[model samples]
Target: MPQRKIAIIGAGPGGLAAAMMLSAKGFQVQIFEKQDYVGGRTSSFTKQGYTFDLGPTFFSMPFILEEIFESSNRRLEDYVTLKKLDPMYTLSFDDLTIKASSDPEKMRQNIEKHFPGYGKNYDRFMNDTRKKMNALLPVLQNKHASLFDYLRLRSLKAIPQLEIGKSLHDVLSKYFDDERLKLSFTFQSKYLGMSPWDCPGAFSILSFMEHEYGVFHPAGGLNQLAKAMAEVVREHGGEIHTGTGVKKFILNGTRDISGLELDNGETIDVDDVVMNADFAQGMSQLVDDEKRRKYKNIKLQKKKYSCSTFMIYAGVNKPVDLDHHTILFSEDYKRNVEEITKSKIMSDDPSVYVQNASITDPSLAPEGKSSLYILAPVPNNFSGIDWHKEKTDFRDLVLDQVEKRAGLTDIRKNMEVEEILTPYEWEFDKHVYKGATFNLAHNLGQMMYFRPHNKLREMNRLWLVGGGTHPGSGLPTIFESAKITADLIARTYGVKEEKA
Candidate 1:
């Protein structure tokens, strides 16, 4: 029998992982990434002797990536060294500061020291979320292609723990009396680019995953993980073509894709095509409007998208006296969130997250200097807030917060090199739809079977893998998306995927 050839579009973690698995399973795999590099948003860049990760500085759930590597008969550690951060990050409120530790007792002690009576509830929260994680594990591990998939025993068992109608803030409120403490636990909703007040309660498991599994940082940076996956694909005889992009999918019939037309005007026939590009952008651009029944441009316009971000990657002349990670909440965080999600505007006092990665890994910056990555969540392109008009002022406001609240004093004066990425760049340069950095929102209505399926229901021999598909966004889940897609394709070819 002739070997099946698979063409994967986009070299993001999901696309790369699928290639790694399928290639290892004896399929001919090729990945085409428009970027001159792999990793997409997860990629890194260097300037003036400073290195910075383009997205996702916080790495969690190593086991998922480990499983991906193991599937290829390789070990993750062989490619990148992992360091578990203690006091994972610093959470800054108006009048309080909490060093979030992964150690249960130490975290409890810190909570008691700050919120007094709320310390014991920490244990209660952890205990309950552990059960929630277990119940949801099978659901996340498998495909949710149709409504019937929800009736499976695993899905049925998970529904009770899903917290159906409650928001993440609502779930955290049950454990902590203080609103600030609750915010500490629920702010992780931002990982999905959703406001905690609107993010589903089941997502409280995000904070739990952090405190339980602990946060990890690879030696070279999180971008190293992407580079590593690309290497594995090569090691397994899979081809990865950076700087090449797909122009459109060539149809075999009304229901199937038989090849891809590249931007260079070349067409490659393939047995299957895996789409790892931004879901909305890919559907709107590469797949003809007539070919898409469910995700047509008109329909996609109505779908909820995650918020965009205002980013500043700076190389400073002096060292920073901060933890590896720091989150500074706005004085009026609720209103700030509203401004982003509801009002569709930028806030004057926006919440900011800063990463002083040079403290954790000196390789990121030259000796005696530091690299700073500052991110402020903002409205996506749908907001109609002119980024070209607001970005300059917004950048100053964010830097001010970093200097005053994060204690990175005189940062502007010490800056040696810098790069700024606004929503405009994300949409135009990065090809992200609406510049929704986290992709589609993880609202209950858009999750599981409602989310784009791993196997494209609308097109035969085509698949979806990325934050845009199940299980959902975030690096961990994105990796799982790759696994699920790869497994499904393997099953179609009668290849049994080894259990991780």
Candidate 2:
């Protein structure tokens, strides 16, 4: 029999991963990425003896990723080395400094030292998060469903106990009474791209993963992981095509995906298709217009996209002594998110997240200098804002925060190369919906069965695997999404793909 031809659009971690897994299963897979390189939005850039991760600078859930490699009878260590960060991050706020550690006892001790009754509560929360994670991890590498998947977990019985109806803020308030502790606890929902007040109750899972899994970065920077992943794909006899545009999904009258057309007006039939493109943009721009109205009339509260960031990627002559990761939140945390969701413009006193990648991996910058990526989530372009005029204002505001928080007096003159990545760029360049990094917010109604499915409605042999798809965003989640999609395809085609 002719090998099943699978066409995956976008060579992101998800698409590349799906291609790698399926190609190993003896399915013919071709990955097309519009950009000249892979990693979609999560890719990197190298210039003048310095390297910078263009997006997503962290990785967690190593086992799930290793499972993908093991499927092809390969080892992740064989392709790349895993480094555990001793101090996950330093949380810097105007009134507080917190050391988030990978060590459980140290983490709990730190929390206890900062807030009374925090020690035991933190430990209990960690254990709970682990249980929730363990319950969820098995389903991570498989296809998704709504109540059915949770029903499969009738024994864990923590489903209702886990609270699927409350907001993250409501849950955190019930657990810890301290404001900073509450902020620390609820910050994990930032990964879901929603305000703690608006995120789903089950997103409490992030709290579990954060404390249990801890935060980490690859030694060679986040892109190092992507390079390793691509290497694995190439080793498995899969082919990747970059600098290619997919014109449209070619379909028959009944909505079966027959093939895909490229920007050059060429068509190739395929057995299956996976789209890693922005879900909203994909359906809006690529689908048949008449079919587009279906998603429009649905009345979904449009996933409250994560705050779009205004990032300053600068190379400086002197390295600041910050951790590999650090978050400098605004004094008024709730107000910052308000500007993002409601105001839709740059905030006056913005919350900044600064990463001195050069400190973690010296290889990221030149010998005498360091690379700094400073980010602050601002409103997406919702309230009729203009980026051209606001860019300078946002730049100055963030600089003021950096100067005060990092204790760095002067930076503009010492900078070697400065590149700004704003929400406008994200919308135009990467086509991110509302320029939001995590795709859709993991709100209560938008979580679980509420998130977009692997299969599009009224579309067959068509699938989606990315931040916009179910199982949500982040490197590990998207990578796991690829595995789940591959398994779904395997089951549908009856190919178990045993270790070869």
Candidate 3:
């Protein structure tokens, strides 16, 4: 029998993992990435002797990556070194600061020191969430390709734990009396780029995952994980073509993708195409309107997207006296979130996340210098805010807040090299739909079977593996998306894979 050939678009984590798995299973795999680098948003860049991760600083759920490497008969540690952070991050409110620790007892102690009476609630929250995670794990690990799959026993059993109508804020309010403490637990909703008050209750598991599994930093940067996956793909005889972009999907009749037309004027016939590109953007750009029944341009515009981000990657000549991660909440965080999600506007006092990675890994910056990654969530392109005009003032405003709140007092004076990325760049340069960095929102209305399936419903022999598809966004879920898609393809060819 002839070997089946698979072509993957975008060399992001999902695409790379899919390539690794399929190639290991004796399939001919090729990945085409538009960017010159392998990792899409997860890729790293070097400027003026300073290295910075383009996106995703937080590395949790290492086991998921380990599983992917193991599938190819390799070990992750051989390719990447991971260091677990002690105080995972420092969370700052107006009058309080909490050093979030992964150690349950230490975290409880810190909570007691800050909130006093709420310390015991930490145990209660962890205990209950463990059950929720157990119930939801099976559902997430499997596929929800049809209504029948949605009604399966495992899915039905996990529904109650889903917290059907409650928001993440509502779930945390049950445990902590102080609103700020609740916000500490719920701020993780922003990982999905959604407001905690609006993010669904089941997502409270995000915080649980962090506190339970602990956060990590790779030796160089999180971008190393992407490079590692790409390496594994090559070891398994997969072809990865960087600086290559897909022009459009060559369709057969209206139901199948026969091949891909490349930007370089090259054409490759393949048995299947795995789309790891941003779902909305890829559908609009690569597939004709008449070819897609479910994700047509008109329908896609109506779908809810996650918020965009204003990013600053700076290289400073002096050391940064901060932890590996620090989250600075605005004085009026709720209103700030409302501005980003509902009003569709940038906030004057926006919450900011700063990563002083040099404190954890010196390889990112030259000796006696530091690298800083600052991110502030803002409205996506749908907001119609003119980023070109607002970029300078917003950069100063964010830096001022970081200097005052995050203790980066001399950031401006010590800054040696810098890069600012607004929503405009994310949309135009990165090809993210509407510059929604986290892709589609994970609202209950758009999750599970409602989210795009791993196997593309619009075209046969085509698949999707990314934040845009199930189980959902974030590094771990995106990795799981790759696993699910690869498994589906393997099953179609009678290739058996070990169960996770």
Q: Which candidate number has the best lDDT?
A: 3
Q: What is the Cα root-mean-square deviation between model 2 and the actual structure?
A: 2.2
Clashing pairs in 1: none
lDDT of 2 by residue, 1-500 (tens): 22889899888888877877887888888887788898887788877777788888767777777888888677888877667776777888787788888788888878877786778888777676666666666654555555676667542464554566687888777678877787787877667666788776666777666567776677777776667777777876777888887888887865788898888888989878899887776666566666543465243235466667788888888876778888888888888877776666567888788888888788889986888888887776554568887888789889899888877667777778888988888888887776777787766555556677776664778888988777788877898778778888888888987895
lDDT of 3 by residue, 1-500 (tens): 22999999999999999999999888999999999999999999999999999999999989999999999878999999999998999999989899999999899999999788888799999999999999999999999989898688898889999998899999999999888899989999999999999999999899999999999999999999999999999998999999999999988888888999999999999999999999999999999898789999999999999999999999999888899999999999999999999999889998999999999999999998999999999999999999999999999999999999987788898998999999999999999999999999999989989999999878999899999999988999999999999988999989987533
Model 3: clashing residue pairs?
A: none
Q: What lDDT does candidate 3 reach at residue 33?
A: 98
Model 2 local distance difference test score? 0.76
Cα-based lDDT at residue 168, candidate 3: 98
- Each prediction's whole-model lDDT (CA): 0.93, 0.76, 0.94
Q: Please provide TM-scores, in order, for all candidate models, with all chains considered together.
A: 0.99, 0.94, 0.99
Which window of ten consecutive residues has the lowest lDDT sum in model 3? 491-500
How far is 79's C-alpha from truth in model 1 (Å)?
A: 0.5
Off by over 4 Å in 2: 138-142, 145-150, 153-158, 296-303
TM-score of 3: 0.99
